[model samples]
Target: MKREHIETMISQEVERIISGTDLELVDVEYVREKNWYLRVFIDKEGGVDLEDCQAVSEKLSKVLDEKDPIQENYLLEVSSPGLDRILKKDKDFVRYAGRTVDIHFFQPYNGKKDLVADLVGKGEDGKLTVRVDGNEEILDMKTISQVRLHIDF
Candidate 1:
């Protein structure tokens, strides 16, 4: 099967297993280094524990075994998204509004490649308004190369 098809299958199976666990699926990637590695990141209101990871792992393993989507030898890793979780979808922007975020643009925006700002809100046109250094800037979602929650230490 194609890699994307396999990934979609794995994502669906993982979502089903963790539906009632209060955990949100952050992202899933199938990496092939020495062998296939399927990494699943999940998060919750507070956080996720090792036990949660283990439970999801076991359940997903059973599903994968039954489905056999991956023909090659592989290892499955289920874990928390951690402090710097990447924001991918529009829902992520809405869900994480009012939080500090670090965004990297494909091309420099206002002569900068990276920005650390407070997410204000999403505009009617679907642009993101963020306050960076006290200046509010409207960023086009299409230009965002990567966006992650910022952790203050």
Candidate 2:
């Protein structure tokens, strides 16, 4: 099966699993490094804990083992997306609007490679709008490398 298809299946299964619970599926990743890995990122209102990860892992592992979705021998990992989670979906862009984020570009934009800005939201024209230094900046999605939530310590 294709990667996107597999991800969609996983998302659906996870939604069924977490239904009626506070846990939210942040993202599902199927990738290969030295070995194939299926990582499920989950989060809750107050953040996820080790117990939450373990429970989801056990249930999903059982289902994956029974269904045997992927042909390859892979390790399954379930965890929180973390504080610096990347904004991957449109819902994320909307959900995180007005929050501080770190925007990185493939090349310098306005003489800077990256800058901290308040996420205004993703534009319908395949661009992202962010507020920097009190002014709104519309960034071409083609030039953006990454946009993740930025937390100050």
| Among all candidates shown, the one with the greatest TM-score | 1
Lowest lDDT 10-residue stretch of candidate 1: 119-128
The total of clashing pairs for model 2 equals 0
What pairs collide in candidate 1? none
Per-residue lDDT of model 2, residues 1-153, tens digit only:
888888899999999999999999999999999998899999988899999999999999888889988988888899999999988888889999999999889999889998899999997898899898899988898998989999999
Question: Whole-model lDDT, candidate 1?
Answer: 0.87
Alpha-carbon deviation at 114 in model 2, angstroms: 2.9
Cα TM-score of candidate 1:
0.88
- CA-RMSD of model 1: 1.9
Instruction: Return the lDDT, model 1, position 69.
Output: 74
lDDT of every predicted structure (CA atoms) = 0.87, 0.91
